[model samples]
Target: MPINILMPALSPTMEKGNLAKWLKKEGDKVKSGDVIAEIETDKATMEVEAADEGTLAKIIVPEGTQDVPVNDVIAVLAADGEDVKAAGAGAGKAEAPKPPASSFETPAARAPQDEGSAGGKTEAPTKPTTNPAPRPEEGAPAPVSKGEATHNGARVFASPLARRMAKDAGIDIARVTGTGPHGRVIARDVEQAKSGGGLRSPAAAPAAGPAIAPAMSDQQIRALYPEGSYEVVPHDGMRRTIAQRLTQSTQTIPHFYLTIDCNLDRLLAAREDINAAAPKDKDGKPAYKLSVNDFIIKAMAIALQRVPDANVSWTEGGMLKHKHSDIGVAVAMPGGLITPIIRSAETASLSSISAQMKDFAARARARKLKPEEYQGGTTAVSNLGMFGIKDFTAVINPPHATILAVGTGEQRPIVKDGKIEIATMMSVTLSCDHRAVDGALGAELIGAFKTLIENPVMMMV
Candidate 1:
């Protein structure tokens, strides 16, 4: 027996997806974990995986086809010598996938064609097969042929409702003419006829109505254009995902910003002292290089312990505080930002945090991280200090109550004991959700972080 491969819902909001590309061609062997295709959902381009070990038998929807709804069979996989018929023979021959509401570019505007006649009379007949498909109702309005007229001497191809409506409204259908289905009268035509006080003959209507200049002929446009072509490109999968997520976050989250400045001279000196005594690599780099980020991570751990409320998420029922601090560090990637978590950061040592950050950052940049690595953190940090950003606020990554953005440290004059002196100062801004965290709580949390940074020794102990 063959296994049917239905389109998977890549995102929560995704209903249908475009078959962007097939990773496994027909007859190719596939394992459960292997990526079989790249599916384009409203959010992103996700890799579709096989559910079982088998050979790719047939692809129902070819690449580039859009509107493949979720859970609809898109392909088939089977073991060698398996019968394809066992997996529904009519799989690929189902009705064409309906495009989105936006894809209905043209209005319902073509003239109806003549119905098939049997023995000199038109008759509706039932279609029979193993499928037992339903048939259209008999004795329905006859499909009008081209150049025919209705009973009132109007074009026979006019829609029945339009003709009857015209009669009820005392408007002439023939004079009104039509802009639908092979020039047949439509509802709009009847409405226009009623509004205009009967149908105006094409020649007489324009003459009596509002004056308008004729449209430029295609030949004239061709003459004006020396040479230029227009092309439309579809939105890539990654772009689609970014757009949807950002929109959702902005629309629903109630975000609030809080800023704090930290003196970093002590932090820098401490990093140097820690790195000097650490092991060295073969290439001469410190084995456990204690960077400013490492100190910040350690300081954050202590701050979280002090202000445990900050290490929590907002929920419908109540404020859900976590016993452990799981921090997600946002890493910039080619497509967008992806944060990898440092689970139980409150308990991890500075050296361990440094190692975990390095590993997760490397994997995140390489796009080799698992789904769990990028999900479920109590709080998140995004640092742009390396890029020389002075100060900035970050968006809250829900269901987390707050996110911290760190900026670069620069030498600045500060008053110490009534004397102005040059000191290294760094700025950080915390964006919080007002629903989950209050202004006073956020300020207090920042104060604790300030203490950890100003007194670096306290964090280590």
Candidate 2:
């Protein structure tokens, strides 16, 4: 039997990916865990490992194929001792290896409960661990195309991984209906379907409410511009993901802004003193060059610890109060921006934070960051101070209760004992998720941040 090589989902929010290149050609010997191909997700290009040991019988989805949906057959492999020629000839004709229909059967007969999809998602889906069998069995069940059902000219909407799971488990995906967004099947649904229950028929699904009418179509938007006046530039994976996540953030999270002015004279003086004392390497490069943003990050992290009530995430089940301050710092890239987190920022030294951010920013621009490096965080910081921006508010990224936006530090006149004096001042805005942090709680959190930021010495204690 020919083993189907489907596209793997590299991350939780990944739906489609670009098949960048294939390292092995057809008729080549491949072993389990061998690197076979490269898959380009939203921000990173990861190497795909071969799950089964066999000969590459066929190449179905060639390299450079863009927007390839997950779980679609990309290649075919023949098991060792099998007729490679016949396997290559049959290639895609062979159905995927499904274990048993009973695998999807369950003890409890109920509809699959997918919290994010059944109603709506509080956050993105969790990445599933997919370890496919390395060999083919003697007998497998008949397969359905991409987990589709045969009825009413209707098609099944399922994530690529769900379809693959159904095929591998010999389950009739049509019988195990979807509970994901817009009735699409997801990994959790498949897991619940394993019990031979918690699945409904596709025909029983509720009808779609209406077409996506709130937004204009691509064609209509294009028509507004004069013909040939502009050349169309398509969005890549990063841009698309950014647009989607930001849109979701703005729509779902009710954001409130709190702004305050901080006297940066102390912080600026402290940063210079710390940088001047930093140890230098043989190449004359300083071990650490602390920046004002580094102080802000440390201050915000400690402030969250002081005002622990504001450090929370809102879920339908309950509020999540994190123990550590995982501070995600926004780093601008060509297509968009990425937020790489500094784990346990409250405990780390300013030098460590600066060093880690420099490395993260360099790798992030090259699209070399792993998903875990940028995924979840208790809060975030977005500083446009380097760009000379006075002040601006930021959108609340989900799973985070608040984000602190920093503006440039410049000389401003201040009154001291009824006498005017010039002092370095910076403006900071805190965007809070109202559901998680109320006005007073947010104010308290920001106040703590202001205190620490203004008195640079306090952060050390």
Candidate 3:
């Protein structure tokens, strides 16, 4: 039997992905856990490893193809002496292509629904939602969730569902008009349709019938808007998953942001001293060199110790605070970003944290990070300091109550004993979810972070 290499969900939020690069070409031997390709998801470019030891036989979706949904086959790995042709033959069937938006009838053609009068009960217009069939090509105008109407000779679109109810109630879509994005008709349009007692133009009367149109390819319609060359890329598996999860998170989860500045003079000096004195590794490389990020990770671990409430997740039942400090460190990649966790950070020494960070960062860039390294964390740290960012807020990674955004440390003036002096200052912004962490608790956590970062020795203690 041939093993199909399907696109793996690189992140919890990833759905569709683009094949960034193929590490192993066809006819190459692969071992279990060997990296096969680099998949660029909305969140990050990640390594898609072989699950079984076999010979790579066929590459299905070639690199640079987009909109490959999760679990879709990208390659075939056949066993020793197996027939690659037979293995690939069974897997070569393509799924049905997504329908184009233009295939559906126009919203104005849909039958109207009944609405009650204003004296007691009133009719309402139906809202339109696209029951989009399968995958629509890129730029396939998504079916309007609302209906459409003609107002003063101008055709305005509203949700199909909304239009039905509005017409049944004897409401004039033209008089009521629209309030949706791009001046489209929405539910609000139906509500105001009755109140809009404005005079109707003679042309406001109903049309003879729906205007029928000829079928055309999506490429043809898109060509009309072309000033420059534009192409529709299908959503890869990873991108689709990302879209779904982010939509859910944004809709259901309430997010809040908090920011603070930490003095990094002591922290910077500590890292330099540690790095200078660190021992060499078996590979003759430095075993441990504490970077500013290592210190920040250590400080964050200590702060989580003081304010355990911040290291928690929200659930339907109640808050679930984590006992351990598994700090995820955000790493930037080609398409997006990934946060690989430094497990048991509270117990790990600065040297160990530094080593692990170096390893993770290198592997992350190379698209070799394992799934375990990128998932499940109590908190997260995103450092833009290396990029010279002054300060900025971060979106809360789901399930983690807080994420610390660290900025660069720059030399600035400070008052010392009534005298002007220079000090190194850095800013950090903590994004917290109110449902999981209260304002006071979040503030206390930042305060603890400030103390540990400024002292630089507290982590050692």
Q: How many clashing pairs per prediction, in order?
A: 10, 11, 42
Runs off by more than 4 Å, candidate 2: 81-83, 93-213, 217-223
TM-score of 2: 0.75
lDDT (0-100) at residue 385 of candidate 2? 95
* RMSD to truth, every model: 17.8, 11.5, 14.8
Model 3 alpha-carbon miss at residue 449, Å? 0.6
Tell me how candidate 2 scores on lDDT.
Answer: 0.76
Model 1 TM-score relative to the real fold: 0.63
Write model 2 residue lDDT over 161-242, tens digit each, in one string: 6767888998877666554433556665576678655566556643231121133344655688766876656556676456
State the C-alpha lDDT per candidate: 0.67, 0.76, 0.68
Worst 10 residues of 2 by lDDT: 113-122
TM-score of each: 0.63, 0.75, 0.60
Cα-based RMSD of candidate 3: 14.8
Which candidate number has the best lDDT? Answer: 2
Q: Write the per-residue lDDT of candidate 3 for residues 284-315, one digit (tens) a residue.
A: 88776667888899889989988887889775
TM-score winner, 1 or 2: 2
